[model samples]
Target: MGAVESRLAELGIQIPEVVPPVAAYVPAVIDGDHVYTAGQLPMVSGALPATGKVGDGHGLVPPADAKEYARISALNALAAAKSVLGSLDRVTRIVKVVGFVASDPSFTGQPGVINGASEVLGEIFGDAGVHARSAVGVSVLPLDAPVEVELILAFV
Candidate 1:
């Protein structure tokens, strides 16, 4: 197994297969020594694990389900990054993570919501997981997923 795969096994994570793009853009792109991943929604087996905005009146269950879905989205983003680098160990730095939180107008916990993704990165990559990040509340997301996350990676 590759570094990412090995680490995931140790950490009990599985880098899911690349989720097919919803539109014209590719799942990821490489520039020089960097890899940029498109926004990844919460997909399991090519289907959304959860869909809906966060905050009041969202989802038949509590919003926690959707929050977990957001975290899952980040895991998928890492999977895409590793696919490009061949090994997560090749990642020298996590440049930035931009997390978009689909939310009700009254919702304001984007940072906490995105923490679901950030925390996973920290656990899987340890110190290398640390990176600049932005969590923004948006009116909606692609396919109305509760959240979407994309990553930028600089490899050694």
Candidate 2:
């Protein structure tokens, strides 16, 4: 395994196959030295493990579970990046991350939820994973997924 893949293995993570895009867009595209990934949902075995808005409100997914979904989404984003770059080791730095949380109207924990994705990137890439980020709260997402993550990676 390449250095980045090895690190992921050490963390007990196995990058799944890149989720096929639901629309006309590609999963990732490389422009110059950066690879940009499409928004990735937390898909496992070709399905979303959880779906719904996240918040303390009734019928909403809990914040903790949403956080986990964020991590899974990040993993999928990593897979998409690897698919384009051939190996995660090709990445020189994580440039930016944008996370969207399907949230209850009253929910305001978007940053905390996005931290789940950031934490995993930090674990896999250390300081190189640190990057500019935006955590957004939205009423819904494609496939009703609780979280979605997209990444921009700078590579050699």
Candidate 3:
């Protein structure tokens, strides 16, 4: 297996098949040495795991659950990015990761939740996985998935 896939396997993480485009945009775009991914929802197999908003009017899932979902979303983002870039070794660095969590006002640990993705990348890529990131709380996401993530990668 490839380094990227192997590493993920060692971590008990499997990169799922690339999710088809939800709309007009491609899953990822590789330009020069950088690759950017479209928003990735917390999809398992084919469907979203959860949905709703932060604060009021969306409380099907708790904030704590939302945080966990955010991490899952980030992993899926990496999967999407790898599908386009081919190999994580070719990844010079993870430039940035923007994670959006569908959360409740009482839930403010979005950054901590998205750490699931960050930790996975770090485990697989070491320093190369070190990245700039933003974790945000949003009202809702497409499919109402609890989380979504997009990645920016610099390739070798």
Candidate 4:
């Protein structure tokens, strides 16, 4: 296995197959020395684990669960990046991460939720995972997924 894959295995993290695009875009594309991934949802075996806006109140997905979803979405993004590069070892650094949270109007914890993704990347890649990021709260997301993540990676 590649060093990145070995690292993921050591952490007991299995990168799933890249989530198929719901629309017209490809899962990832290579540009110069970087690979950019499309937004990824927390899909498992072709289905979303949960759905709804995130908040602490009734009828909303909890921020903690949403955080886990963001982590899964990041894994999906990594799968796409590896698919494009043919191996995760090609990735030298994570460049940027952009996460969107489908949120209840009162929820303002987008950064904490996106930390799920960031933390996982840190566990897998150490300092190479540190990157610029943005976490946004939105009214809704496609498929009502609670969180979505995308990534940019610099590769050899």
Instruction: Give the candidate number with the greatest lDDT.
Output: 4
lDDT of 3 by residue, 1-156 (tens): 767667878888776778888888888888888999888887778887666764434446766566666666767777777888776657778899888887776777788767867876788778889999999888777877777888898987
Residue 61's lDDT in candidate 2: 94
Q: Could you give me the TM-score of model 3 versus the true structure?
A: 0.86
Which lDDT value does model 4 have at 65?
A: 95
lDDT agreement with native, every candidate: 0.82, 0.94, 0.77, 0.95
Query: What local lDDT does model 2 show for residue 43?
Result: 94
Q: How many pairs of residues collide in each model? A: 0, 0, 4, 0
lDDT of 2 by residue, 98-135 (tens): 99999999999999999999999999999899999999
Which residue pairs clash in candidate 4? none
**Ten-residue region with minimum lDDT total, candidate 4:** 1-10
Candidate with more favorable, higher TM-score: 1 or 2: 2
Question: For residues 1-156, could you state the per-residue lDDT of candidate 4 as single tens digits?
Answer: 788989988999998998888999999999999999999999999999999999999899999999999999999999999899999999999999999999999999999999999999999999999999999999999999999999999999
lDDT of 1 at 23: 96
In model 2, what lDDT does residue 146 have? 94
For model 1, how does the per-residue alpha-carbon lDDT over 1-156 read when each residue is reduced to its tens digit?
666568789988877888888899888888999999999999988887666778866343245666687679888987888777777778877788899988888788888878888888888777888999999988878887888999998888
Indicate which candidate wins on TM-score: 4
Query: Superposing all C-alpha atoms, what RMSD in Å does each candidate have to the true structure?
Result: 1.8, 0.8, 2.4, 0.7
Clashes of 2: 0
Q: What's the residue-level lDDT of 96 in candidate 2?
A: 96
Collision pairs in model 2:
none
Who is ahead in lDDT, 3 or 4?
4
- Evaluated against the true structure, the overall lDDT of model 2 is 0.94
TM-score, candidate number 1: 0.91
